[model samples]
Target: MADRLDYGEGTDAQQFVFLLPEYLKDTSKKMKTGLMFVKLVNPCSGEGALYLFSMCLQQLFEIKLFKEKHHSWFINQSVQSGGLLYFATPIDPLFLLLHYLIKADKEGKFQPLDQVVVDDMFPNCILLLKLPELEKLLQHVTEEKEIDKKKYYKYSREKTLKWLGKKVNQTMAALKTSNINVGARVQSNAFFSSHQISSDKEEDYICYAHGLISDYIPKELNDDLSKYLKLPEPSASLPKPPSKVAAQRQKRNK
Candidate 1:
């Protein structure tokens, strides 16, 4: 959920509060010039999304801002209105690579990873090719060939489905272990002093994990994953969601 901010019409100066991983501060000592913000394709939306790239660490981070109407923050010496809290989370580079591979798949040709990743609109996509062990990561979702000692890859639907299944399983296990309340039966008893929420139904875990995982892939692949997992059809009455500011798909006029 990376965001690209814009100064809205007639907007006032605002303050930002961020919660970041400690590792970033540690990594900063190695190099200063390699840190930057770049726009690249969002694996889930196939749209421009902002990301923070560290060429030194070869790491990519997803920035997510949490905003609420009429919120304000009081710093040590001043009060700032429209204050928002942001988080920096590590993103799986493979997901981003898969986005390009799926698009390249339409060409019906095995192409070198570098050739396949070129983006005219978001040229910084080349930085992704610099990530370490990229060949090993691509093995999860691609079929490749070696030509003249160079490797070429094409998206492998079979392999990708298997990989996504594993992702769902991993997310589901975390949900269960964290004692998340995902079922209506659990939430309905929220006010009861004697209630326990960890006993949610098995389907609850699957649905919750699917919702979270869907944010990282395109709608078509999401639908395919749903079917592959045999998830029950979602009800049409519920509207989709994500409230954030961005020039990306996640953005809306604030």
Candidate 2:
């Protein structure tokens, strides 16, 4: 797959290699318009980011680009530049909805989900409300009040923190199960840590898990989660996750 192209005439046209959930392929066979890509507000950064919305499945997937230097793909006797790969992974819709809910909280009033999730920048955010069990998911992060058979919701920081804590715990458990050495202070651009920590160091697992979770949450929320999880104080000098480190390196190259 990494073979460099050296043969015949190659077009300057760009080629993208994508990795998507296998289920989407079957869904595509029946309907085409149901699956599409859109730019939506990134919950963590509030910036425009690519997302795949499945109107058929009422699901959302996060889109990420993977690229590296000195890499090429030989495709049907043509060379493709940039050696870029795109990934589409399924994501929880609530994480994206939480961004708007927290913002709407500034008003400190219970409102319908429709009003709370509106985004002028990325109007497609409304599609989130269409996801199944939104009411159930919202219950995890918001306080709901039913009046005259209609439900209204308001963001509850207490509940959100608790939910985030559960997420941290889940991530920590996965890290330990996978034997990841997130406790080490060494920096390397690989998934495996260069330095190893004892498996018994539970704190390391928590801190490492927090760092991974930090990628999905805002800085302020991440700080709050750090305190919630009772991990060590965060320091900027610490090494970031391999994916984040690679992204920073790519940004610098650009």
Best by TM-score: 2
Model 2 has an lDDT value of 0.69
Query: lDDT tens string, model 2, 76-96?
Result: 566656646565556778888
Worst 10 residues of 1 by lDDT: 245-254
lDDT of 1 by residue, 18-44 (tens): 423332454453254455667899898
> Candidate 2: which stretches are off by over 4 Å?
1-33, 70-82, 185-188, 193-200, 235-238, 244-254
| TM-score for each predicted model, relative to the true structure | 0.73, 0.76
Look at candidate 2 and give me any clashing residue pairs: none
| For every candidate, C-alpha RMSD to the true structure in Å | 9.5, 8.8
> For candidate 1, what is the lDDT?
0.69
